[model samples]
Structure formats: structure tokens, C-alpha cells
Target: MLKLFEIVEDKSPKDRIDELRKDIERYNYYYYTKNESLVSDIEFDKLLKELEELEKKYPEYKIENSPTNYVGATSLKESKFKKVVHKKPMLSLNNSYNITDVIAFTERVEKNIDSVQNELEYVLELKLDGASISVTYENGELLRAVTRGDGVEGEDVTENILAIESIPNFLKEAVSLEVRGEIVLPLSRFKTLNEERLELGEEIFANPRNAASGTLRQIDSEIVKERGLDAYFYFIVDAEQYGFKTHKESLEYLEKIGLKTTGVADLITDMSIMEKRIAFWEAEKENLDYETDGLVIKLNDITLWEEVGYTTKSPRWAIAYKFPAKQVTTELLGITWQVGRTGKVTPVAELKEVELSGSKVKRASLHNMDEIIRKDIRVGDRVFIEKAAEIIPQVVSSVKEVRTGAEKEVVVPTNCPVCNSVLEKEDGLVDLKCVNPSCPAIIQGSIEYFVSRDAMNISGFGSKIVERMLQLHYIKDITDIFELHQHKDELMTLDKMGEKSVEKLLGSIEKSKSRPYSKTLYALGIPFVGKFLGDVLAKKSKSIDVLASMSKEELLEIDGVGEKVAESVYNYFRDEKSLEIIQKLKSFGVNFGKVAEDKKDEVKVEGKFTGKTFLFTGKLQKFKREEIKDLIESLGGTNLSSVSKKLDYLIVGEDAGSKLKKAEELGTVKILTEDEFLELTKE
Candidate 1:
């Protein structure tokens, strides 16, 4: 935790270098072996730079096997994966997030090649945001597949590789060569897999990249096969052995031999043309099947690539042009407030139109009064805006340098922005909300919620339709949706709503009346009451009347129903508006008393697995990790996020890491394989 300044203050040059080397080594171990990082990449780079500088000044201290010599720490020790030394080190590319660094990269390339910028050919490829893998072939037949563990030695995952249908077992031409590529889970396939998992009552993957990485590491090849992973060969490890003169030729040859390559790779002679192509891809990246964070540009000519050489980690011939961070600096023109269905008023910063990521931005959320005060953000101030994960717009910080006295201070309103109703806050709540049940924002939000896919699931009903319905006064309360059939002629006259469309809309609304009890409960938009909880409540209630009659203490008796959730439900049912809505829904034949058939009792148990905690490490052969976790949770067991002395069981699988060592140290924690754990469950 020592700062660089504190460490180097009184130390000798050699001592400072040694300290840096040791510190970085420790960090690398934690990052690579423990799957945890204590320091940011920027901080690591600063230490590395200091070490490199000291070593350069005092040549004697330039020790071999220094952290500078290695690309990264590997994950090959004490695991099941076989090790494969790369034929040619799969060097990484130096990345640039801005045009200045890219221009400098081109300048460096031109200097090394002794040629004009336009004279050199560059092979530009989309940088797939997935795990890097090296596949070696023997006489056109499949041999081994290795992950890029540390650029030197890597873990062999041949069995897992074979599961990918896109990768040919044998190439068209008989040749022995090593090819390097990225393993990716296509976005569509990723979504489908998540949907399937959700249906099976399993945890869903966060992203396609993580899904692909997890799939590759899974011990069960059948699971991998069903998930549908893909690979795109980018480079022949030793290009000269394949008789390829240019990078473009090698890629073409890979495709010719029935090995897949990214279809987006382009060979360009002009730098400006390359820039334009990169710009085009950056803007349209959302449409790509697999995730790509950036573009990799390499010298097209093999001889030039060789001459350019490589640094300690990255090849000099290639550089990754990373997409600009979603953040952008713009002038804050004004501040506006928006009230959501939950009655939470959020401050939105209206900005001078600026391009961020791929879209033109004008407004971003300031979150709340605390955020506004903390940042001291004001109107007419130049503010830095970032799209949180390239989606929600957020104001990161404001530039105080440009803030003039003319800038107005932002004030949190005491009244609702839409309905002008007095704002009130709950005892333990941070958000100020309009307590009025008929608040415009609340009404709109409730209507939107009732018609959502997980609720009444009305087809052809969306944001635009809701807005139009509100505007036309077709429905005031959510219950008025049932009376929509009476306004058939009015709906038919509205824009984009003809007789056929109105009929379809009415049919969807009519069909929604028979939605299951759990879905109707969720559609009520009660605080802390999610679809899963709604299902639990519906299974327990069997009737809306029974649910309404239940006391707070009675509601709290249900498992996973915390005090806040129980109180919210109890209070909701006791409300006059809620009672009226329930009566109206009942009168309309909406299925509010019918519970869907499910194995709701399976997850509630007190036998063998009760109060037991399980931590899964490495990989499992018999079942996917998620499936095992689900099984543990279903049997009254908790899934531990990390290995500790408190862990009751550590499920060790293939390529187990530091968690295994920690469990061994703990001694009290029981370690079990997938089959052994299954046997224990049978008891």
C-alpha cells in the first residue's frame, strides 16, 4: 500500500529498482494466480517505468527474470491443464485510446520501416473482446489448443477446443503449423444461453466475453458444445514457415485452408483510409456478432513486421487502437429534473451537444442532491460526462477552471417536477418522492409496469403506446386498460393505429386479463416486490383476498421476505387504491388468484445441506459450476464468493488456484469433487 514517492524517498537506485520488481511480482501473482488485482494497470505501469529507468541507468541491476522480462504471470501451477510452450510468443499489442498515441504509433512504424506513411500496407482487424488461444495443427489434423496464460507457457484445453463447431478438426491442406486466434461467444448465442439458464432457474452470465471464457474453462465438453462457442484465427504464429509474405496473405491462407478468420479484416495502404475504416467499425460495433473493444492494426508485410521487432510485452509492428472511453467533456447548459414511477426525482444535466462513445449526447443524470453537492456541479460549468457501460449517461466531474460567477447553483426541488405535488421522504429512505398516489409519473410508471413482458405481457404495447395512451387520456389508472376496448374508434383514429392495429391492441389487452396470479402481483409495482418474490407470495397466498388479509408478522414468516418487503406488501394491500384495483381486476376476470405450478418447495430444506456453505474453485467435470451452485442453494446452502477459513466446503475442479491452497491451510473446510459432493447430497 506504500506510495511510489514514499518508497523511493531515501532508497538507493538499485534498492528502488529491487523494491519495484518485488512489488510488481507480488501484484502480478495476485492478478494471475489469485484472480484478484490490488493495483490498477496505470499504477503498475508507473512502477514498471521507474524500474526500467533505474535498470537503464545502472546496467548492473538489470537482473534477468525481472518483472520487466515477463509479459504476465501464468495460471498453470497445481492445476489439471497441460502446459504448452508457444511456438512463437503470442505477444500483446500496445493500446491507444486516443488519436495522438495512434499517430505516434504510425510515426514509430514509418521510422522503423524507413518508408513514407502511405507507402506501407497495414492490416487492420477488429479486436475481439474474448480470451486469446493458440491452436497447433499436425499435418492438417487437430493437435492441441492452448490459452494465452502468460505469452510464454499456456494451459492446454484441447478437449474444450474440440467442442467448437466453427474450428475444423483438419485443414484442407496438410500442414503442421501453429495458429493464434480469439475464442468468442456470439452475442445472439450468449443471449439465448442466458435465456435458457433463466428458464432453468439458473444464474445468467454477465456478458458474451465472460461466457466464452467460462465455457472454454468448463471441464465438461458437452456443456461447451451445447453453448456454441466460436474461434477466429488472426495470425499464423510463425508466418514465414507457411510461405506467407504479408499478414493479409496469412489470413487469406487460413480462410483457404478452412480455418476461420474475422470477416472484418481489411488491408489498407493509406493511413487516412485506415483511420476512416476504424471510425466506421467503431460506430457500427454494436452490430457485430461478437464483442470488440477496439481494432488491432499490424504491418501487412511480414518482412517489415520482423524488422520492426518487439518490446518486452508488445510487438512493435502492431498496436491496438482502443475505442475512446464513453466519457466526453462538454459545457453544462442547464439542469432538469425527471420524476420516475417510484416518485424519485433525479437531476439531469443538459449539456451542449457533444459526441460521446458513438452517439451525440445532450443530457446526463446527476443522480441526486448528494451527488450534485459533492461535485459542486452548476449550470454553465464545463463538465465531464461518461456513459456508464456505454449506456446510461452520467456526469463524472465538473471542470472548476471554467466555472464563472455567472454559473447558477443547482437546487433540489421540494415538489414533484411533473405534478407539482409536495415531495416527502420515508424515515430510512434517501430519495424524496411525491406521496400522491395519482402523481402523473407514478401513474405512467405503474401503467408501463403492468404491461411489461414479465407482468401482463401485452404484445405490441411499448413506451410509445403508453405515452400515446396517456396523451389521449384513454386510461388514467392502470385498471382503465380493461376499458380500452370501448375506445376502439378513438384508438383507430390515432396515428399508426388503424382498425387492424386497434384490434390487435385490444386483443392483447383482453388476453392480459388471464395473466397468472404471480405476474399480477409483480405488475402492482410494490416496493421491494420482484417477480420471484411475487411468485413466492402467490404460491403462499393462492388468493388476493388472503394476501390482503395477512398481517406484517404473517408476511415476514415467509422465507426471503425481509421486514421492508413484508411491510411494503402489507401496506400496499391495506391501501384503498390497491383494494380498488384488486376489486376491478377481479371484476374483469384477471387471474389474480391462480398460482402457476412450480417446484417452489425444493429450494427450502433443513436436512443434509442445511446451513452448509460451498465454494467452487477451478473447474468441474460432471456438471457446470452454475448448476452445482444452484443445487447447493436449493438445499439450504450458501455459495461462498471467496475462499476463507469460514468456508464449510471447497469444491475443487480442474486447474484449481490459490483457493485450494487456502482451503488446505484452513484444514477444517471439507474439499469435495463434483461426484463426491453429489454423493453427500444423496444422504
Candidate 2:
């Protein structure tokens, strides 16, 4: 027989295995929820591998719900599911491309309902960019999980469902309920997994959604159980059985049952307020780890939901407000430097033909050297870009997962692409600047800026025509606008040009020559002179000549014209190149005086609610706080910086702040509802 200590030690292998199981689950919860890791990935992986190996060695040691099973089991092959006609149809949400679309949605909602007597509130939830799965629990016991197959019958995946630890095998409170959730991988995890695969010489997954779908559908349940996946439950089917009076309560109940619920779901009773919350989250969605494509808005009251319920394919009580996808990919064929209106060097990516956000995007702006380095973007990399919310085209990220080794890195230009002037990266700023104002790039950029809206507002002179003129050597700078008449014959020969078009273009150019001094100043495209400050400076000056001669101190006297703007103006006027251009422009009949009349300010005392933070939770009775925010801001006060002690008062709208209870505990001032807010403001 073995010695007693040795015999015990031999038997202790089972004991050590039990301890490892508990440790892995605990670490997983900590890492996933708190984002706090007690061990490195390698350390964690080593322990997990040990546990997995032990479980495989002794199948009896495997716990039903283990961290090793996060990938879940392979879904059943051709499994049958009883048809479940949804009590409510899983309606697809309406998508919005911009704020105008959102506004239109809100207007349609209000118009469909009683605008005054009943306040149409909308409960906002994030639209997850992942695979949607529905789970059913009978008498609080885990039963089945299925994909939303055409919102009817779905493949039975009960064996696979047992693998997700987050899905409760048995609910703490025994109540039969069914819930729908999205299984997704986080951005960080998706990137890390792809990186790991690259090192292992495996093909990369394009994105989290693709990876998640592929993982879930894997034929081997054991493999599915290996890759970590998470799910966020958002809704409860048959919510009435749970005694929930509102959709908000149903969500709260789901959260109580240990499901990951959306953080942004709020009970909005006021139409305008609901609209604003939807808008707020649309902007805030970018900050989250997981992608939310849009908002899932539902009517709050359960009774109202039932009454307005179920169309053939959608629920009348809810709608999804989708945010447009801003980031899209294209192959970067090459890099070229373009000088901006500010004389700052910009890297423009020449891309292989790709469509993005409904536009055929051929070239995208790299913004500056810093952006290029930060994204690690390359000339041949599959690049993702957005116009930065329709403002300016910008390369957002490099799709490293899709990169072919053939793709080359982008190298910053040592000189301007157009003028070949030396490029300088200044301290404290990310942009590379071309110091030569007379550099051909800046000259061309300035001319474009001159004809732009804030400048001479020239109607017909566009980028294509300007480029053609430059190529023809008919024009060199802003003064060249007036000189265009000398090249009518050459301009007519350009593509899409005829005598009629040339006449219209020449007429517009002639009209622009006599534009006001502010227009002329704007057309100069002085660095830092944006539309707003340009307006202020133009109004302050008697003429372009006077403004050009003014000192920095004098320029600072104008509102909105700060020191930076003053410096740019001063530098432009001081430059010999700029002086020559201005003299040339004047000789060509460019106007040099004020154009538009400034409107008078109507001042009123700030309202009582000024600077007070008002958090609306639950449902509200009457006005939407979105309209309220507009009213408050118009009265020269700011909406408070979230709910805190510094808040002057919390306007307790209906179903007001979950944070309100916490605010009360913290002794923050609370005002019940917007009615009280209106009364207080009246006084």
C-alpha cells in the first residue's frame, strides 16, 4: 500500500480539479463584468486549459455550466422546433441616415397619435449588431434556446444552450418566461482573437458578428464551448404573466434575473423627450465596447402595447431607430498629399473603387500624420472610412483582419504632392504644414476656398473647373477668378462644357468679383478663419484693406475671434505672398467691404431652471424633455451634467430617475416632474 501522505496526495488530484473549476468561473465573471483581470491572459488560459484537460480526462468532472463552454455546443443538425407564433411580431426597425430622418420619425409618431391629450413616450434600447437568439424557461428551468428563424419555428439548440454560463440553468425565482437576446463578441475581443489567429497561421474572421455566427454554428459542441461569447437579454415574451405593468418593468425584471440588459434603455413618456434620448444614444453609441447599430423604441405602458399590438410582421407599439453605419472599407491603392485651406498638409488615400454609405468613394482624407499612425493605416490596407458624420471624408480604421500581405504601409510625404514644398510637422499639433503660402498646393486650395460658400459664394466655379484652369495655366490664385474671362475658349473645350455653360460660369465669376470685403476676406482662405469667426471679423472691419492692417490686439476685440484666429489673420497679412495675392485680387475687381447686416440680440433673464440637471426616468405625462432642453438652452442655461449633488434640482418626470433614489440617498435636491419645473420657472 502507498504511504498515507502519498496516498492522500494521489487522491488530491480530484480536489485540485474542483478548485480550478471554481477559480475559472470566478475569474470569468470578474473579467467580463468588471473588466478587471486578476491574472494575465496566458495565466488564465493555462488554468483553463488545465481544467479542460482534466474534464476531458475524467468526463464526470465536467460541470454542466463551465467557462470552457462559452462558445456553446454545435447547434442541432436539422432539429425540429414547434412553431411559436410570436404574441408580438418581431418587427424590423426603421433606420435613419441622419438627424433629419430621426426628426421625421418623431413627427410621424406624434402625427399618428393625439399630440396633446396623450403623451406618446418611447422606450429606447440599443440595437445590437449580433445574432439574435430566443430562450425559453419553463417554471424557472432552462428549456430551450433558438435562433429567431423567420420569427416563427426555429432550430432547437437546448444542448448547446446549456453551455452558456450567463444563461441561468435554473432561475432564482421560479416563473415561466421566455426572453430574447443577442449573442455578440466585444470589439477588443474580436481584434484580439483575430490577432491570435494571425500568429497561429489561421484565416482571420472579418468581424465580431461573423465570428460569433461561425462559432455558434460550429458542428462540434466542444469547439463551440471554447471560444468566449456573451449575450445581452433585452425583452421578456409574455411579460404580462410576470406581472409587469410596463416594458420598462419587464426589462428591470430581466436584469434582476442576471441577464445583461442594455444600459441606455429608458422609459420615455414624452414624445419629444423620447426623440432626444434616441438622438443622445445615437451619438453615445460610438463610445461603447459592443456596437449598437440603432435604438429599439417601444411603447411603455403594457396596456397601450396590447391595444396597439401586432401587425402582420411588426409590433405597432415599437419601432427601431437605426443609426447609419459611418465606417466602411475600401482598398487604399496609394497615398497623395493635398494642402488644405489652412496651408496644412493632408494625406489623401487613393482607393480601389468601393462604395461606402451609399456613395461611390474613390478617395478619402487621412486628416493628418497622427491619424495615419494611430490607425496604423497603410497604402494597400483595406481601410474603413466615414465622412465623419457627413462633415469631411476621413479614414477611420484599417481592417487588419482582412489585410493581404501584398498591402503596403503608407509613408508620409516629405513634400507637398502639388507644389513639392517641404512639409513640417509643428509641435503640439498633429497636422503637417506647408510653410510656403505661395506653394502651388496652397494657391489651388485658397482658390477653391475663395469660391466656397463662406467666401465669394461663387455659384459656378467648382473643383473640377478650377483643376482644369490650373492645368490650362489660365489661372494661378484667387485673383484668377476675375481673369477667367480671358480663357473662355479654352474652358469651352473642357469636358461637359459648351458656350451656354461657359457663359453661365463666366457670369457667376464676374458677379463674384465685386463681392463684399468680408466675402473677399473669407475668399482669402486665411488659416483659422472659419465661417463663424470670419463673419465676426468681416462685421468688425470697415474694409478688407483695414482688416488686413489691423494688429492682433485689435482683432481680439471682436467676439468669437480668439487669439489663434487673430494670429492666422496677422500671419496672412504679413506674408509677402499673401500681400501680392491681395494686390492682384484688388486689381481684378475683387470687392473689399462689408456684405451682410448683423442681427440684433434679444436678451432676457435666464430661467430659474438654468444650469439645473433634470434626469427623466420611467414614463412622463406631458411634454418631451427634448423640447424642454431646447427651451432651457434657449433661455441661456445649460442642461445639467448628469444627476449629481451639484444639480440644482432633479426634475422628476414620470417613471423618473432610477438614479433619483440614489440621488435621494446622496441628499441631492429632487423636484417631482416637469409640472413642478414649469411652476418653479414661472416664479
Candidate 3:
């Protein structure tokens, strides 16, 4: 609770006025500094009103630092305001790419500093995307407000600023000082204004930042007021008016004046910890009402800030930590169809020139027909595209009103584009699949699946090779993969094909045939029978035959196998064609579960990293590529095809790819090496 009255309850009316001064100051501190509530906002206001009444009753009790003095009667004077010099130059913070950059900054600070008395703490402030300015008041009267043009001389904006209600017209006391802050529109208000503009057929602002800047620069002050702009005062440029020895203290004093300030600032001595706070903000940007491009990190001690002051463009005492973006908005040009690995007909969206994070995205996955209807996304609508924290650019949302009306409604394709197979939308599922396994498109997809992680776990056979082989018709089915050994000469004739590469690919194919029954089962593309279910049945039964013979009730009895999954598994095995394929695989030396084999010594890391996503970046001298990846898998971490915000870590290697830099910029935690990673598990 805030100390509203420092005096005893039995004090006289004059002494009560003195007590009210401390009471209001403490309440202000609680609201601004602590982000805590002792009383309701209305209750605090009532106390402030009572204090104002007391001061009026006994003017002698009105102190220079009383909260009542923060505002006062405005003088009707067009006279030129006096120029005031700032005691310390306020500097901008360094923007961050990711949390690592924030952490790195903190580490640098800790490495350079010798010692500290207080716990090293840092304040996190939203870097408002609006006009920056300084406002001054003299003898409790509204004086002048100046723009931060070039960080020095600025155009007079006092008339324009006064239009804002949050800015006080008079001080409760005769206090005089200069306060610096950003003037911005709340996100809700900005959206409403933009919507109104659009309805009126006026030119719409590109974003809230643009809108705030344009509104503040209007020639007419009344127009600025009419926009309902608000200012959040955060820093004090003058100290003589209020007895403040530190930046934090000045913020407290400003709060007493009823200026809105950030609720998340902290005092920090260690730059490393401050870096962590800044990094957290990068991930927290979308959650804030006001736009924060980066974090504003300031030196806590005002004395230290003075000593380690200004450079040419920024102050050494502060830095801004900025995060890189991954998803961005663009216009939806149209929707198209693509056949997936399971011969599923999926809808995709083509975008109109928008850069997401850093990539220029022109195409995005729309998932399926259901997603299209669910999102109500139409062609020509402005949409948000995310190069998801996983692979693939995905359509996340559509700007409904941005439609040009030339857009057409997309029709779900009835036939597979690749082989003209009848596309069947599953009853319980949203995906439209071409269930004909013998379709040429299905064959190509099977090959793609065969080398996938859940199947053969082949290290080398990537998409390009699969596409080339599919186009040449060099291999048609899983059986044809075994037959690739006979076509090495023909394969060498293709572009980028050589004896060594062909030999390696054929060798991988030969080795894939020796994979466990579970992998072969999973590789067969049985719907709902994923890696986990495969593992369950593989362990529960002695062989693939026994597992296939199990009833639906018996299958569900196995842990992790649901009734729907069991039905799919049971039905797939019951197919004569599927049984024939399994026989061929068995003949090709694909290992079945042997009852006599040592089940206890099976591959120790099965299904560990089967689903968890991971990213690899930077350089590591300690472990080889395969070793690092194998370790991650051992811990149940799934390796993502690319680095994204959802990734657990970006394992750094020497001469790392752009992913490391990108991950760091996004504030994703990066793992250094095998040893460093192992250390994390210990914790």
C-alpha cells in the first residue's frame, strides 16, 4: 500500500494537509513505479481532490513538490517561450536482432564492469513508434512543447500538444521543469481513425506510426486535439524544479504530475541481464498496445549516465534492442492447388509483393478447403503470411476490406493435378486426398516419403534427386527404389549425376530395405499411423504380421493408439495391394520384428526427438554435424527443416549459415556445442 499520509491520524487540519502531500506522492509511486494498485484509480483521484481542497484551505501547506502543482492555469500569451538547455542529452537505444544479441550486450557490459553495490537490473520500455518531443512548464502554467527534430532545435508544438487531454494545463504547485516523452495514439484509437478514413474514401495511413506522425504535424492545433492524442512523459530534462538525483526518481516525480509512463522499466547494473529483458521484449512486441520496435535500455545511476554520456548520434549509457520479423502482410493475388506427398490436393495462395521477416514471399500454403472457408480469405484481399516457426510460408489472416472486388472465389479441385486421380475429401478430416496409391503422383510422393525422417532416415536423398528420378520415370514405387541399382548407368546420364552420387544414392536405397518393420509401416503412408503409433505396435507385437492381425479393440489396448488410428492401421493392412507391397519389402530384406531378437537392446534413441523442433546455426568446433543432430534426437527434439521462432534452439557451428544470424535477430536461444548443450540438461 502507498503511504498516503506520513502524519499521525490525530493531526490537526493544517498538519493533515502536510500528510496529504506524502499520501499523493506515494500513490503516484505505486501506480507508476510499481505497476501496483493500493486503491482504485477513482479512489486515488478522490484523494488527490481532497489534497487539492486541503491545500486551498491552507495554502501554507502547499509544498513545491506537491502533486497538485504538476498542472496549473495556462497563461494566454503568444509571447515567444524561453529556450531551455537539457542537462543531459537523451540517447536512443541500440536495436536488437534476437535475444542472443540482448544477452550478448549484457555479457559485454558485465565483462567490462569491475564491480557493483546493488543488484544489476535493467528496465524494459516499449520503444514507441510515434513523435518524440520535450514539454516545459513554468510557474505552474503551460509553456511550450518542442519536437525532437535532429535531437536539438525543434519546431514549437506547444499549441498542438495542449490539445491532448493527458497533458496538464496547470501545475498543482508552482513547479517548473521540462519533461521528454513520445506522443502516440492508442492502437485501438488508431485503428478506429484509419477505419473512418477508409470509410470516408480518404487516403489511409500505412500504419499507426505514420498516422501519429501526420496528426502531430498538422498545422491546426485543434485538429490534433480532435484526434484524441495522448503523451506519456518518461524523462526529466530539468532537475532544479524537482529534487531528483536519478532517472528513476525523475520518473516517479513525473508520475506525481499525472503523466503516463511505461510500467515495465527496471534499474540494472549488469548489461547482460538487461540484454535478457530486452530480448524478451522482442518476442513481446505484438502483445503491446503501442508499437515497440526495440527495447530502450538505460544506465540506472544518473551519475554514471553523465560520466558515460553522449557520442555523436547516441548516448553510450543507453541502447535499443530490436528483433527481426519473420511474418509480414501482403495482398492475396489468388489461390492455387498442389498435390502433397499423400496425393492430398492442398490449396496455396499467391501473394502480391510482400517481404516477410527477410524473405520475399510470393506463395504460401492455405492448408486446405476448410482453412479457406474458415479464414474467409478471398483473392485480392490483403493477408498476413508467415514463414511459420516451421517450414513453408502459410497464410495466417486476410484484410477483408482490402479486397478490390476483382478477386474470385477459389473452387476446391475435384481431381489431382498430377495424375487426374479422383480427389477424395476424408469424412473426418479436412484434407482432400487421392487415395489411389498406384497414381504416378502417389509414386513420386512415396519416394519423397521413403527418404523422409519418419521412414528410411536417409541422410542424402533430398527433393531435387527425387524430382529428377520421378520425371525420368527411373523409379516408380518403393520396389523400384530397390531396382535403382540396375539403373545407375542411366542415372549417370542425367544432369548433376555422377558415378559417386549415383553409387551413394543406390547404396542408401539398398540400406533402406533393411530398415525395421515400424519404419516400413510408417513409410507405407498409412493414414493416422505416425511415428509414435508405429513404435507402439512395433514394440507390442513380435512381427508386422502379428500387429496386422490384431483386432481394432486389441489395437486400441496398446498405449497411445487411438480407435481412429487403429482403424486406419487395420484397414491399410487388410488391403490386398498393401499386403503385396509389404511382402515385396520383406523379400527385399526389410527387417520384420523377430521374436527371438534382444528387444531390450533396440536402437536406444527411438522416437526421442521425433516431434520436437530444433534449428542449427553458427559454428561449433566440438562436435560433427551428425553427432550434434543425433544428440538432439536422443533428447526427443525434432529437427526443423529451417530455423523459426518455434524452434527450441539454433545449434551454432563455425561458419554458420544465415539462419544463425536470423535466429539471433529473432531473439531465439541458440545452443553453442555438444558440451554446452549437455550442460543445459544438467540444469
lDDT per residue as tens, model 3, 8-103: 667787767666665665655544333333543434566778888988887765643356643211111122333343333344455555656666
User: For residues 1-683, could you state the per-residue lDDT of candidate 1 as single tens digits?
Assistant: 23444635788887787777778877666655443335534455567787878888998877434656444342212345777867556767788876677778878987765334346778889999888999989999999999986566688899989999999999998998888899999989988988987885444776787677767766568877988998998988757544566888888899999999887769887667877888899999988888898999888877555446565456888899988656689999998888778878778889999987555789898988888999999888999998764567899998998767898888779988889999987787667788787887888888877887678877556656776788889889888999999999887786556677678778989989888788888898888887657876886666676777778976765545778888899899888878998899888989878432432333334567776878876646676555886688667776655555557998876655556776887799999987899899898
Window of ten residues with lowest summed lDDT in model 3: 70-79
Per-candidate local distance difference test = 0.77, 0.65, 0.65
Model 2 Cα lDDT, one tens digit per residue, 1-683: 10111233455556767777667656554443333334433345567787778878887656434456553222121223344544333445544555466556655654433222455556778888887888888888987777765454354656655666667788777877789898887878777887887885444666677667656655456655666777889888756544567788888888777677866678666656766776788788778888677777777766444334343345556666767556777778888777775678778888787765445788888877778888898777887778654435677888899877887766767876667777888888888888886786666776777776446766445565566677788887777778778888987786556677678768878888777665667667777775445655665565676677678875764445667878988888998977998788777777776322431111122566544445444444555545665666565444543345655566654443334565676685665666876776677
Best by TM-score: 1
Please report the TM-score between candidate 2 and the true structure: 0.41
Look at candidate 3 and tell me the lDDT of residue 133.
Answer: 79
Against the true structure, what is each candidate's TM-score?
A: 0.46, 0.41, 0.41
| Candidate that scores best on lDDT | 1
- Candidate 1, residue 679: the lDDT equals 94
Superposed model 1: Cα runs more than 4 Å off: 1-326, 516-518, 531-561, 593-683
Better lDDT candidate (1, 3): 1
| Model 2 / residue 15 / CA error / Å | 80
Candidate 2: clashing pairs of residues: 71-224, 74-221, 121-269, 273-624, 517-592, 517-593, 617-655, 618-655, 619-654, 652-673
Model 2: which ten-residue window has the lowest total lDDT? 596-605
